[model samples]
Target: MRVLAAMSGGVDSAVAAARAVEAGHDVVGVHLALSRAGGTLRAGSRGCCTIEDALDARRAADRLGIPFYVWDFSERFREDVIADFVAEYQAGRTPNPCMRCNEKIKFAALLERALELGFDAVCTGHYALLVDGPDGRELHRASDAAKDQSYVLGVLTAEQLAHTYFPLGDTPSKALVRAEAAERGLTVAQKPDSHDICFIPDGDTRGWLADKVGAERGQILDRAGDVIGTHEGAHAFTVGQRRGLSIGTPAADGKPRFVLEVRPVSNTVVVGPKEALATAEISGIRATWTGAPPAAEEFDCHVQIRAHSDPVSARAQWRSGGVTVVPDAPFDGVAPGQTAVLYLGTRVLGQFTVDATVSAVAVDA
Candidate 1:
């Protein structure tokens, strides 16, 4: 089998590419230049697609004795991930750029180009499993539950899964992958894993949004529709956010306040008690299935709203092109523009971007 190993210049990806070569497949290592920020080097494991990262990926490929190349996809990334991120926030919604990258750039664009170039599969270092199910290949959690990345990959379509390959899915831990890289004489063995969003170098999301969309001072409304405080821009806020809101005044109940809603139309930031973030229902859009869409119109399933949050029990109602999930109990922080991945046991049934939420507690605008 001819495979294109998508090396991310990290220990996990180096070991994954080595494993792919060890499996007797014809493999080629390819580093994606997604950032293309004047070829600057990444510092402290914060930036992705930096010149240093590309060099590290090349070094790993040389150690593995495979052909290596860098594929530039910065324009696509800016349009699909970065631009979409700013747009979503400007519209008073929270967007997950990592999920967007997987959906648009990695799995979709790269996979398509790989197929066109006569590659049988596009391999990555993602910690997620592909198991044969009753219907076809089904995605599952990795052996290392803590490092499972199946959530971000929830936006993958059935066609994308047909050619997707995760070589590190069954690895017990990331440490072991680094150890394997050491054994294979790869240089990325001790490279620190990136934790922050790639584009936000300093990790100041509010500041970045502020720079993008200039400050527009607006009223911060209480639950009773009365102005409590003022904020620079509503685009800098997301539903359920607690910190960074300089509300100036505390809630009458003396409890910590949370952002209940961000109204872009009214240019208002609504703040109330943290309990106001609790939601009972979530409506999702742009649903994509890993394999086949469920034939049943409605069913009980596990819904994962956040990447690291535990999957909550939910009753899902399948709509024409999307699904509405009602949690068995109240769920907090059901933010819009986030992916809601659905699962039936360990198998990923599908996922959709959250567009609307119905909180258990009523919130005022």
Candidate 2:
């Protein structure tokens, strides 16, 4: 089998490529240039896809004695990930850029291109297991729970999972991968893991959104629709955000308030007690299955919202356009535009982009 190894200039991806080579898969390495700015440099592991990273990927591929190339997917990335990110924020939703990258750039575009080039699969360093279940291929949690990435990858469809490969899924720890890289003489063995939004490397998300979405003074309202304070912009706020709010009126009980909603259309930021952030039910659109569709319209499962959040037992039902998930216990601070990954034990059933959430705590008019 021919494999396309996505070398991201990190230890995990380097090791993943090396392992692919060692497996005798006729591997070819490719580095994706997501940014067109040639001078973009990584800021202390805050961002990725810089010129330095491309060079590092080249070096790693050379060490593995594989054919390497850098593909310029900056335009596609900007349209699919960056633009969508700003649009989601402007529409009062918190978007996970990494999820979009995996869905649109890596698994979708790259995988499509790899298959067109006659590669059997596109392998990466993602810490998620792909098991050959009785029915078909199933995506599962990685052995290292701390490094599991199946939550983000839940957006993958059955066909995408069929062509995807994760070499480090069963690895016991990231330390072992680093040690392997060191033994293999890879220079990125000690490199720090990238965090925060890659485009906004400085980690100043609020400032970045303010600039992109354009700051406008907006009213901050309480549950009863009474204006309690003012904000620079509604886009800068997200559900469950407690800090940085300039509320002029305090709650009657003197309890701190959290951002319950961001109304981008009205330019309003709604604040309420933290209890209001508890989500009882969540429903979403654009559902995609990891393998076969569930036999029943409703089934018991586990729902995970964030990348690192624990999966909570839930009941899911297939609706007309999407799915509705009712967690056994309410999830705190769940926001629209987040992806909800459903699981049956270790196997990922599917995922959907959250469009609506019902609060566990209802407010009195």
Candidate 3:
């Protein structure tokens, strides 16, 4: 089989490409240049598309004796990932740029290009697996659940899955991959993982957005409409955030207040007790299913509101271009624009963007 490995100049992708070669398949390395000049610093150290990263990928390709090339997808990336991220925030919605990248860039654009270039499939270092199931190709959690990235990849369409390969799905821990790189005499053996978003290298997403859209000073109010402080921009804050609120007043109970909501139009940030953030039900927009939409009215599943959050028991119902999730237990600070990924056991069923939440009924009512 011929495979086009998506090398990101990291030990994981390098090892994934090497593993493909050892499996007796023809392989080529391709790195994506997703950033333009004056790109924002990455969120964590785990960034991609840096000049150093491209050079590392080239070196790995040379060591593997496979043909390699750099594909400039910066324009498409800006359109699909970075621009969408800023737009989502400006619209009072939290967007996951990585998920968008997988859907629009990696699985769609890159996969299409690889097929046009006569490659059988495209490979990546994602810690997820593809298995042949009764229905068809199925995506499963990786062996190392701690590192499983299926949540971000849950948005892939069925057709996209048909042409994708996750070579590191069954590989050992990330530590093992680094060790293997050292054993093979690769320079990036000890390179720190890229933890930050590729476009925002410094991890200052709010500052970046403020610079792009222009800051709007707004009033910080309590639930009772009392002005407590002032904010530079409403888009700079998110639900559950506690720092940089600049609210001088202490709570009636003398506890620190947290951000409860962001009103973009009025440019107001609502502050309240932490308990005020709890909600029973959440609604989402732009829900995408791996296969066809679910046939049942309500299904038992586990829902994850954030990338690092543990799955919680919930009931899901499909609505118009969206889904509503009611957690069996109250979830705190369910923010708008964040993704709610659904899972049936270890298989990722689908995901959607949070739109709103339902308050629990009062005891008297």
Encode model 1's per-residue lDDT on 157-219: one tens digit a residue.
Answer: 777888988999998988888888888899899998887788886688889988987779898
- After superposition on all C-alphas, the RMSD of every candidate to the true structure, in Å, is 1.4, 1.1, 2.3
Q: Order the candidates by lDDT, highest first.
A: 2, 1, 3
Best by lDDT: 2
Residue 208, candidate 1: Cα error in Å is 1.7
In candidate 3, residue 160 scores what lDDT?
A: 80
Cα error, residue 105 of model 1, in Å, equals 0.5
Task: Summarize candidate 3's per-residue lDDT along 102-183 as a digit string, tens digits.
Answer: 8899998999999999999999989998888777788888888788899889888778888888988986587887888888
Candidate 1 vs 2: which has more TM-score = 2
Question: lDDT values of the candidates?
Answer: 0.88, 0.92, 0.85
Q: Summarize candidate 2's per-residue lDDT along 88-173 as a digit string, tens digits.
A: 99888889999999999999999999999999999999999999889878899999999999998998988988998899999999
Error of 1 at 179 (Å): 1.0
> How many clashes does each candidate structure show, in the order listed?
0, 0, 17
Residue range with the least summed lDDT across 10 consecutive positions in model 3: 38-47
Summing lDDT over every window of 10 consecutive residues in candidate 1, give the lowest-scoring window.
36-45
